[model samples]
Target: MKHTMLAVLLAVVMAPGLALAHSEARPGAPADGETLSAPPEVVRLNFGGPMRITVLKLVGPAGEVPLARTDGMQPVTTLEARPEGELGAGAYEIEWRGMGADGHIMEGTVDFQIEP
Candidate 1:
């Protein structure tokens, strides 16, 4: 009984940390696996807590697409960036890496397609 109680107490203490460690940013505009008739002017991400985005890249058929970040390099709940110019119809992926509120590095990609 004592061992079980200790285990339960340990779990209760570690649950929040575990949750925070797993917390990651969710796709906002131009969601993952989204298909659109036209190119999106801006890219966005919504985070559960504060995150400092280190890298944000837009890759298209031609290769790396340039983007103008609106959020700069800072901790934020929502991050936004605009493509340097109008994107051509093709398959695109937005890759991002950031430091979470818990100080862990998290990275993800959002793939989208623009119909020709």
Candidate 2:
């Protein structure tokens, strides 16, 4: 019983730290699994804390698409990018990798569809 009690105490003490360690940035615009009637003007990411985006890619039905970064390659709480050209109707995915405020490498993807 004493061992079990200690284990419980450790879990309670470590829970918040573990949660923060696993925290990740989330898509702010053109949200994950979203379907839109038209293309979004910009792609945005919202981070729980400041993060330096290392790589950002936009993939469409045809192939890889190009983007113009508004946030540059710097640490920011919010990051934005604009597509260089108009997007046609199809599925799209935006993948990103970054160095989180905690100095850990973090990555995520946002999937959305453009309706014809």
Candidate 3:
């Protein structure tokens, strides 16, 4: 019976790739040496599990850039983004915090540059 329980536990632990869960930014964003043609309108993230973004903020050079205010609050899943201004052509970083449906908080950042 112990061997059978061990087999079940091992399978549960090895299923999904946790390392690939929290993504940083949307595609086409500038990397370390990459140049972007246009500015991104909003910061986006792709999460592996269903989640609610408890906190999503775009931090600019100064301090914190305000997200375009929304009419109503809604539960978020999959890719999360703020309703806000066009990410102007410049250096920017996206800061985000999301909670998995299972209640774990997932967070990360992605940096990109926009060519003037």
Runs off by more than 4 Å, candidate 3: 1-34, 69-75, 80-87
Give per-residue CA lDDT, model 2, range 1-116, as digits (tens).
Answer: 99999999999999999778644776589999999999999999899888899999999988888999977697988998999977999999999998976788998899999999
lDDT of each prediction vs. the true structure? 0.89, 0.89, 0.58
Q: Arrange candidates by TM-score, highest first: which order? A: 1, 2, 3
In candidate 2 the C-alpha lDDT for residue 40 amounts to 95
Rank candidates, lDDT, best first. Answer: 2, 1, 3
**Residue-by-residue lDDT tens digits, candidate 1, 57-116:** 999988898999877698889998999866888999999999987888989999999999
Among residues 3 or more apart in sequence or in different chains, the pairs in candidate 3 whose N, CA or C atoms overlap within 3 Å are 68-84
Q: How many clashing residue pairs appear in each of the predictions shown?
A: 0, 0, 1
**lDDT at 18 for candidate 1?**
85
Instruction: Pick out the ten consecutive residues of candidate 1 with the lowest summed lDDT.
Output: 18-27
Better of 1 and 2 by TM-score: 1
Weakest ten-residue segment in model 3 by summed lDDT: 23-32
* TM-score, prediction 2: 0.81
